[model samples]
Target: MATADGEAPRPEERQIEPLHLPTPEEIRGQDIWNNCAVRSVASGVMGGGLGFFMGMFLGALDNPIMQEEMTTKQQLIFQAKQMGRRSISSAKAFGIMGLIFSAAECVVEKTRAKHDTTNTVVAGCVTGGAISAKGGPKAACVGCAGFAAFSVAIEKFLDRHS
Candidate 1:
């Protein structure tokens, strides 16, 4: 059908934005970041950094055990060492915790096919149980229950705030 002097379809005549093709580099970058392993690792690293800072702050607040006997320089050195040790130890724990929680959440989300609090609770249980398994079955059960509860509370708080 022809319009008043129109040979083209109205859809075609309407303005259309030009398609933007992502470059090969952009495609590869997206693929790399979208990978599950990369995402877990990134989360672990970020968690570790947060834990490190927290540990440092807490360690700095600690009073030297022998402050009365130690010279000023000795006290400084002792505090520095304490901070470093605390930071590294907490960082390791936080990194593992983050990685496990992230991976578990991803798997739970994928398996359940939903994005909701149940996934968070399951992931928290898995992570906590796995982390505490070394303490024995009872500890693992306790950890799972406690973490699941904590996860639920956090989920509710976030949902309410959001």
Candidate 2:
């Protein structure tokens, strides 16, 4: 359509809309997220199982003689402390393990796909620290898994919609 002057519309007067397209990098991002979801679930299960085993093993380490010789309150205190220690140790161990696992995954991604590994490592560390501080090893595992799943879901959703 032309204006009263019968001239084509100027470029400045025309609206320019930007088109969105998926780049190669975005495809890689989607793949990373898909992998992350699976890995997180696996890591959580393993960590939780290991923590349960460790807790059981630690609980069984009480000395029979020591138990028999202790006063009632002393025994109670000892038991409480032992339980507390187990939780603390389990959480710390799992957290550290989570970090290691993430690091390994990041390295693998870098080597195999030459993808951006930054997000994986950062997410792993955050998940590990959170689980360690709040839920112990079992909690850490669960948290990591959840975090991974959510992260992947969000990324995929954004990719598809955008």
Candidate 2 C-alpha lDDT tens digits along 50-147? 77567656854654367878898888777667766775677557645654555555555655774543455446545554645575777777677666
Model 2 residue 122 CA deviation (Å) reads 19
Q: Give me the runs in candidate 1 sitting further than 4 Å from their true place.
A: 1-33, 160-162
- Whole-model alpha-carbon lDDT for candidate 2: 0.63
TM-score of each: 0.78, 0.37
Give every collision pair in model 2. Answer: none
Specify the poorest-scoring 10-residue window by lDDT in model 2. 116-125
How many clashes (backbone N, Cα, C below 3 Å) per candidate? Answer: 0, 0
Best by TM-score: 1
Give the per-residue lDDT digits (tens) of candidate 1, residues 8-58. 658766667799999999999999886768888998999899889988988
TM-score (C-alpha, index-matched) for candidate 2: 0.37
